[model samples]
Target: MPFIVHVLGFATFAQGTSEFMLSGLLPALAADLDVSLSEAGLLVSAFAVGMVIGAPLLTLATLGLPRRAALVGFQAVFVAGHAAAALVPHFGFLLAMRAVTGMAYAGFWALASVTAVSLVSADRRGKAMSVVVAGLSLSMILGVPAGTLLAQHADWRAAFWAVAATTALSATAVLLALPAGRDTTAARPGLRTELRSLAVPRLWRAYATTALTISATSAVFSYLGALLEDVTGIPERLVPVVLGLYGAGALAGLIVGGRTGDRAPFGVLLTGMGTVAVVAAALAPTAEIPAVVIPLVVLLAAGGFATNPAVNARVFGILGETRTLGGAMNIAAFNVGIAVAPWVSGLAIDAGPGPAGIGWVGAAFALAALANTLLDRHLTHRHRRTTSRSAPTAVDGARATTVSLYAGHDRPL
Candidate 1:
């Protein structure tokens, strides 16, 4: 990986910390603002909503800007939001600040994705992505936990201020480290032409697959702490330990998936999805068995995260000149997964399956993702076969033009 890739990952660590740190600070925030716990919880939801909308919208807004400048600009917004949130006493003001910070984070995600993919050669895109994914995983393991500790020792506002300071430093690193230019890997056509690239069904399928697989994982993950406490019978302090182990699996799986996903995208998808499905389904029946459930938690996180690099790499592979927009779309899809899955999991809990229901429900979603992957592979192979069978006819005038287009002289993303 390039040095700049690591810088991008480091920046991600700073921004991603704020993404999940709200969970740890919710109780304090509620008491400080004199609001209901449920109302304070909306602050997290506001961020998710910002992420979902900001990805595509902000990506497009900065479509024509220099990559480094856009990243720094987003970082500025992120820092400002955090600083404002830290000072603001009102719940509504803090909520708005959280949303603005989320938008900044999502925009940076979109730009950083395209930038990362562009930095590496085609074959190593997945490995490069793993570096960035490590930032996110590490945020779970290190950053959020650290923020929580800060909130414990000091104040929740201290945590917010910490994120602001870290984010500013990250932006400075980006300004110094990354080059001041747009992505040269893809041509910048007019806005309409760029939009046209997204019409490809293959790209949409890739995005849908991303959303579904992640949603499957989150359905289980969102309630994992509760399940560990209620069903697994683990001590309260040990719950974080198990969760930390799960976080370690994400970092560990980065190496496993990063090394292999470049050559075997489908293999990673199948194995990862299959592992998650099996582990999740088994968790329901074995919830009381600590020996089984503990390992399963680690496996679930590893299996789910292992697919992330491959998914991003596949998106870039399928994209045409609209790599920026496609990256944004996929980022939007990711936030969709994060936002929607918890709600689905909550439904399972409400319907009387209790915390154990998340496992089976997640299993079902994983299977659906697996099936989608199989079907996508089938269609892709069929298309390749059909195209090869008619390569001879591609030499004839109109056919030649169409063949050229299909082979990417002027293709869809």
Candidate 2:
């Protein structure tokens, strides 16, 4: 509803483009730097590590500054990091630049949702947040492929330069668009309060749910290309086309999640996770069938990302006043899942199961998350009913008053 929403989305697109394009450019980077492929791959891990720690630590370090200022500052650093990567001569320096970019990106992610929600009414928070996330989906569909094409046609360094330039534009746009003021509404908690906020046990459950739900699907997705080629009997040339289908499904899921999340967050989460688990189960059995497996891949991607809006909305609901900290923690949780799940799946593949077994592993993760969600729902309902029964009611007060005025009230109307 607000123009600022698009501004934030543009910034998110710039960041997402920078993040996802690395995979496409990795080969060129490895060749140019005279490094092994594995070493180049570690650069991705290094970026994840930065996000895993930087999101919260940076938020804590800059807790008192106005959110808009923090946003602009982070984007500036992000632009600088990419520019350094573009110009750096050595592999190690480029790796350091990637880490810096990741840290800045994570800090911006941690605050951007909060800022978007702040700009709109409470009811539209999910919708606004989803638009921000769609930037990533669009990156997966367009930016990564385009960057790969650029690298193929010209040089990998050109991709980095393009991202750096885009980020600079986004930083300037954010500076001009968002209101320049401190968040006067949310109380800025002290260090101790922030620590206590992190201590909430229920919040961790929500985080676990978010992480596990993402891992369930990402495990399968991370290896979709290999699986399609080896297990599904699909030709190597068609893998990208199939992957594009998955991306489209993800976009659809994001749209559906955005619309329903504000109305029924838990319901949306349960449905999405359950659907993912079911699709994963179906995948293992039909891995050899191209027609079935192809459709299942789409469904799996949709099911996986469909949980995004609900996961975010539910965490914010649980954290209340500490949403900034909670949002940062949740983003960290998702990145942790992204970093861990694929490795675990690879272990499963090596243990005896073939490529097809990855789907089963994902199914197990989804089921575990589903069980946790059901448990949370049960506990919430039981607590509410218990509180209702024990609460002081109007009838109790009426009874107490009757005793005080019994003689006078003997004659009823």
Candidate 3:
């Protein structure tokens, strides 16, 4: 199970590195392609749009398939997309290939979460999920910076080729590590039934919280390189190193965040969100102070990345029998935020580099996330109270054949 988890993590590591490395290489890509930076920025946006569109739809379409086959197939698609990106000469074709890559990313991310849960016993589910999510965090910490270094020394094409190679390696690892005929059909639920789960107020609140949190993080992160250059006057050669440091903070936060989630996910989330708000506000005024800037950036990255596992765990916990679909939707919410943030922040940057303006943008989004978190907590508390008050009478009237609400649903192992 640990080996299987590691293999899945490697695949996500490759995917995430490819997706985010674009930000660091935007200037190189524009220079090579003879396009404006804005045009190159579209490549990032295109991938996010693909994820937002593909996650839930593809998950639903491939429902009931063997998990191993689905995993392999999606990764194969990703390899093909990277191959296209590596070989394609035209800018238009490259953008199109990125969209295809995004679709594969959505499939992989959704399936990876569901598969991670299935691989573990009920008591180990949280650990399993964290191990998988840590892959993404590691990519941010290591893979993106490594890819950026590769792009710096070689051509941008080298980075894409490296991504393809990593995907192939990860695909091979997964094939060898996981057992044959591992079934996911038993975990499948009806689409309508899964959709109905979203109608629960608590569920929407969770989704809203996830969306706002992601939007808040991405609003700043999508432009982090630019922010470093423009605000802190960091040398271009140093941006990757700084970004790597940010990724390091994120990796550290992911580890600490998982342990924190086990104690109290909601409490952790509120605290993280509040911390982000304060960090963003502080960042706005301290860009010139490296002592202040570095720590603030670390805090912002740590707080934002830390919230991910807890939020995911909370949503899946509420999902009961529809954990797979629910997990996919949460991922969808995240990608939607990614898609929206760059375009919005890009507009802000294009308007003028006020430097501190980006921090304010980040701050505003964090405030919104804090609001949503509080709202979710309130609603969840009220729902629990109402359920406790009515439980006995409802139990007396229930049919004998009624399914256990939590039965067969993947829970923390």
Candidate 1 Cα outliers beyond 4 Å, as residue runs:
22-44, 89-94, 179-187, 230-233, 393-413
Q: Rank the models by lDDT, top first.
A: 1, 3, 2
Clashing pairs in 3: 122-412, 122-413, 123-413, 124-413, 125-413
Q: TM-score, each model? A: 0.87, 0.83, 0.91
**Per-residue accuracy of model 3 over 195-311 as CA lDDT, tens digit each:** 887776677677888887777777777767766776788887888887788788777777777776644667777778888889988887887776788778888888987888777
- Per-residue C-alpha lDDT of model 2 across residues 7-102, encoded as one tens digit per residue: 888888888877666555665676788985446655665676678788898988778888778988998898888777777758888878878888
Best by TM-score: 3
Residues 1-413, candidate 1: write the lDDT tens digits.
78888999999989988876664566567678998544665676677778889998998898788788889999999999989888876888988887888888999998888888777787777788889878888876877667756766788889889999999999999988876653453355556866877887877878888988887777776667567767789865566567667778888877898887766777788899999899999999998889999899889889999988878777777774357787888888887877777667667777887878889888988998899888777776666556656665545645744543333212222
| Winner of 2 and 3 under lDDT | 3
Model 1 pairs in collision: none
Clash totals in order? 0, 0, 5
